[model samples]
Target: MISLSLPSPAPPSFKPPNPNPKPHKPKTLKPSSSNPLHNRPIHHLDQAQLNKAISTLDLMSHHNSAADLLTYSLLLKSCIRFRNFELGKLLHKKLTNSGLELDSVLLNSLITLYSKSGDPVTASLVFEEMGERKRDLVSWSSLISCYANNDMEFEAIVKFIDMIELGFCPNEYSFCAVIKACSVKENVWIGKIILGFVIKSGFFDTDVCVGCALIDMFVNGGCDLESAKKVFDKMPERNAVTWTLMITRYMQMGQASDALELFLDMVVGGNAPDQFTFSGVISACAKLGMLSLGKQLHSQVIRLGLVSDVCVGCSLIDMYAKCMVDGTMVDSRRVFDGMSEHNVMSWTAIITGYVGTGGCDKEAIELFSEMICGQTIPNHFTFSAVLKACTNLSDLCLGEQVYTHAVKLGLASVNCVGNSLVSMYARCGWMENARKAFDILFEKNLVSYNAIVDGYAKNLDSDEAFKLYGQIEDTGFEVDIFTFASLLSGAASIGAIGVGTSKQLFKCLMK
Candidate 1:
């Protein structure tokens, strides 16, 4: 949603003298002499420099002159790099008004600009405006990627088919985009058909990117992990991205051990792991509670100069927190402190670690406040962690404030946040608030029932607790040990029950 304000293009006009025009020069503007602007350092320009460049264009228009294709292309590059749609729109207006004929290269850039800006209809119009001679492979590929990246999977697939029927040879980029579309639509059949085409076209042998796309296709289209592994095992070459992809998929499937083993293989194969690779492996260490292994990996991260990466830093923080030795969060805090930047994930990890460590609830709450003050919005996990801290400190006042924040964000009805709110209110001896939070939950699980029932039982409201127990039975929920323990506690508080009542309770428990 980046926006830039510039003057609208006017019809051809003569130059007019400005009495007090400010002197402005764009700094470090080093566009190369041959085919300058489009491929140069215009992307590095700040707002003021970009304004100066546009002002130069304004001066051109004042002289009834149109900027050449190179100038327009460079400005378009700057606009795309900054995601400034308005500036691009202005460029389009000027380009249209100019008598210059659109070349395929400039048209391709326009297609890409519109596509990446999430305006596929305009992209389609631009594509349609091109003659058959002007529609090159890059033009087709850009359109396919636009559709695939913007959730138009069906259109992407159809366009791939159309491109093939039109006698255009599909390249690696084309295969990757179409395969991604198939993956999104769960069209494994079409993906495998494309795999055959890939092999026949020799892209599978020459381009590792095509192979990687196939692996992702099979993995995301509900195929087994072994299918993805088969593609991985047969690749002619593997880059850090390819290795990281497999490792990450393994982690997503809950096979952390398998992911770790693959990382070892990746290293042994002389492949260098990137920040994402290190992050995935460190997460494996965290899951297995391998503190020593995690520390070794941390050393590797520091050596590789990736310790400053936000993702790697977050993963290290989480690993050290989960692998706390002697109940000390010193390692986790040290990692958090050393991080150059903090995103919501990093902030949540540190706050959660402090909450899980004993006697650090106040510290956790303070960190949460700091996160808010830094303009980092808290997610459901963040709210849950701070609410747990509130419960531990018996700070109902702070808990209520946190709940208000969650409500404002509309996360109060989210399952994890709602469950945490109920637990916090119940523990704080506010059954009414607890019940209100419970009722608004979009869906409830056993934990929700247990929290309210336990609250009533502990408060010696045996009648309400028993009624909730009946409702639980009517709903066909299998009563767990917690329910039995709470009901027994309630019964004991009201003195011994008669034989018939005891028999009925035992019967329900057996069921």
Candidate 2:
């Protein structure tokens, strides 16, 4: 039984703040607009505003805005906190302009700032500027982490080898970075080598950091869930990150039920879920399409004060959208409307839900319009989803317009979007346009072939559909049962009794 406390009822705040949120807008020092640091106690400003203050001072050319130890440290912290590469770049330019010595501490912060912001190019530039002799262990670790965090696994692993060559022994953080890097590329041999390093460095048992990272590397990176479970089972301690990682990996592997089981275990064991934990389990519930379970989780989110978290809010939007029956995206829209921020993921999730669940495709398309007007860059998935909506609505003109948008965005060639366009054009009886889309695609998976062929077939183009059916074999795509069925149906529709009989016999032989 999943044991959870019935959360204390509170006056409706409507949207919940993330757990560990800033204390009701604490009385932090505000930087004056004229001069960011003027009349400001530097230490009293929150990291977020401190970053802004730093930017304002730089912009105003505050010549006296020196990068003192305290001021620079706060600036670096701000860069890390905000994931603001532009701010980090400004700070770096200011540091060089000030002719200040690039100390190890300052350089590490810059490297970390750039790395966390997914800019290893600049991070490496900072690392290369520092001589190896001047670099302490922290510098080496940060440089490796810069690559690892940015998904440059090869770069990170190569740097780790170089660090080992330089005789700088690996620490727990270094191991964590290396392990995380391994999780992306699934170089199990390299991961095995990293495990050896873990054992040799005497961190395998003692360092809980390595233990959790190893589990993540195995399950997430290597896709070896059994091994991850073993590592977690053997670990003497596990924190929220570890538990959250395990749950998320389970979801990634399509083991949402197992993820929910572990989430229950984590809660029952008194490990109160943080934002990520709730996000993962709620996502699992959404996948299961269990509306009641999803609602229960939403209540828990409200009670735990995580509704305002962008990630949590996004998950809630997706969950409510998926759990609701067709044409019932009201709850999902409410969450999106209430959110203080909306990233591409949040927008994509709701759009996908609306289209995929056969809900309001028109609403999905309208939302996409709003997203574009708001300047949220729509990726190929967004194009794919909205195109699907157009197909469902039989809005060929609108579908063609979205296809134009896809071309403008360089997403027209994306497999799913391309397939969707073919499907859309076909469903709307635009055979010539569908064939054009089918012809231009560089690669055609079974789904692609099915979409285009089905489109042509459904439109009563018996000759064109049969030609394409023959071309599927020439192109080395085995015709599936769906192919024969659709083709025979097309033949039947065109009153081609002979072709239908031949296809039926061929299908039976193939089967």
List, in order, the clash count of every candidate structure. Answer: 0, 1
Alpha-carbon RMSD of each model? 11.6, 6.3
Per-model lDDT: 0.83, 0.80
Per-residue lDDT tens digits for candidate 2, residues 1-511, read 3435532334457565765555676565344334445534353345446555675546435556444554666666776776777877887787788676778888888888888777899889889988976688898899888888887888889989999998889999999988888886456669878898788878987888889888878876678899888888777777788889889989999999999989888877777678898899889988888778778888888877788888888788888877787558889988888887888888998898788667578889888999999999998888899999999999988888989988998888889889998898888888888889988987788888888778877888767777777777787877788887777788778777685558654764575
Note the residue pairs that clash in candidate 2.
183-221
Instruction: Estimate the TM-score for candidate 1.
Output: 0.75
lDDT of 1 at 455: 78
* lDDT digits (tens) for residues 1-511 of candidate 1: 2121212223345545553376665455445344333323243354445655665665666666556776677778787887887778777877887788988888988988999889999999999999798999999999999998898989999999999999999999999999999885467888888889999999988898888888888778764689889988888888889999999988888899899889888877777788899999999989988777788888878866789998998899889888888788898999999998898999998999988886899999999999999999999999999999998998999998999999999888888888888888888889898889888889888777888888777777767877888888887788899987887787777774667558757986888
Q: What is the lDDT of residue 303 in candidate 1?
A: 69
- Least well predicted 10-residue stretch by lDDT in candidate 1: 1-10
